[model samples]
Target: MKKLAIFLFASLLGATAQAAEYVIDTKGAHAFIQFRIKHLGYSWLYGRFDDFNGSFQYDESKPEASSINVNIDVNSLDSNHAERDKHLRGEDFLFVEKYPTATFKSTSYEPAGDGKGKLTGDLTLRGVTKPITIDVTHVGGGKDPWGGFRQGFTGSTEFKLKDFGIDYDLGPASQTVEMILDVEGIRK
Candidate 1:
């Protein structure tokens, strides 16, 4: 009877499990937000935001219920060229003076097994909000050297340049931009 009672208790506990909450480890430089766009149909221009932070909730048992939120500093864009970076920050592109921040809030997650899924979220940029879907892959998760648990994920999404109302005319080949996000979160 005691054995049966213990089994029933364990079953109840398992049924009540909840997702683990985590803060993106930006302070540790384990999180990054990057982008790539065609440069005049000749080559690709890659850049990354130096300042961004976020958090997420994930549970291996219920992956579909995971969620995440992130905020980015628009002025933190770096493209390795000072002149181009300046132009990108002006009225032609980001216009950081007017819109200094961007954000993403997850709406849903669809698991596809093998640590892959599609994450749909509302992305706000340049004062406009639109739904974007990211293809996400769970990197791995385990205990850190400091004895804290961590989870990591990599995701990518692409959207048309004009979708956010920044129609600076980058030509037909540069009509889209792709973003890559690598997030490692410490369990909280």
Candidate 2:
């Protein structure tokens, strides 16, 4: 009987020490995935994926064990211009009809210091999967007035357009695109 009690206590402790699961607060519009690319080697074109959802696992005790997964609706991209947005969705660029979705699944996290880290993942875009790294920073965390605990993070990265099978080149200066992501997760 004593051994059984001790085993149960140890199991409870182990469960408490494990990572916390969180759902990205997309319904509140508190998260974003934005991007920018040079336009014709002269100006910049900025846009964002307006529809995306994801979840994450995090633990204060073992930050390196964190993980995140996101799915993006490629057709939901908005650049604030109608004609250009349509063109971007066509075969020359994203080809949204054939590839309507994109995704990112984090494989590892490396803490750098000062609440910042390197998040490496496999990004699947345009039916191509490639490894990418995002420089991430822990924005903040706390309990909200709605009686929910939340944590936020911001990340940025840049990759060559050709790397993701996007070969529609405007010019040499427009070979790469920069991406920025912000997420706020509510503990579940």
Candidate 3:
């Protein structure tokens, strides 16, 4: 009976040392999902998805255990131009009516020095799932004035539009798209 009690106590201590999970704070207005793609090989066109929600598990003590998942509303894309936004949501691009959401699920996290890391995940876009890697930088984490614990991170990745079946060719400008994510999470 004494041995059993000691084993249970050890198990509890180990669990307490594990990572904590956090839910993405959608209401904070600090989280953003932005994109930039070349236009006509002359300039870059910028856009953002206004609606997204996600959660992450983070362990400062063991950063490799950290993982994240996010879902973005395709129809919420905004490019600052109504016409362009509409076109982007149409069949020529996202086809939001048929495939309304894009998602990312982290498979691995490799921490780099100075609060940076490479996060590799499976990205599902336009009904296709492909692996992608994002360079991540931990912005910071702390307690908020509202008495909530918060953490923030920034990540960026680039991919070809055609890789996810977005094959609309707008000349040289249609090849690649750069995606950036500024995410904040609240401890649950």
Judged by whole-model lDDT over C-alpha atoms, candidate 2 comes out at 0.93
Q: Which stretches of candidate 1 lie over 4 Å from their true place?
A: 1-17
Across 29-143, the per-residue lDDT of candidate 1 in tens digits comes to: 9999999999899999999999988899999988998999999998999999999999998888898999999999999999999999999999999889999999999999999
**Candidate 2 wrong stretches, greater than 4 Å:** 1-17
- Backbone atom clashes (below 3 Å) for every candidate: 0, 0, 0
* TM-score per candidate, chains pooled: 0.90, 0.91, 0.91
Tens-digit per-residue lDDT, 101-187, candidate 2: 999999999998888999999999998999999999999888999999998999999999888888986889899999999999999
> CA shift at 62, candidate 2, in angstroms?
1.4
Q: How much is the lDDT of residue 79 in candidate 1?
A: 97
Q: How do the residues 1-188 of candidate 3 rate in per-residue lDDT, one tens digit apiece?
A: 99999999998778656877889988878799999999899898999999999999898888888999999999999999999999999988999999999999999999998999999999999999999999999999999999988889999999999998888988975699999999999988
Which pairs clash inside model 2?
Answer: none
Pull out the clashing pairs in model 1.
Answer: none
Go through the candidates in order and give each one's C-alpha lDDT: 0.94, 0.93, 0.93
Give the best candidate by TM-score. 3
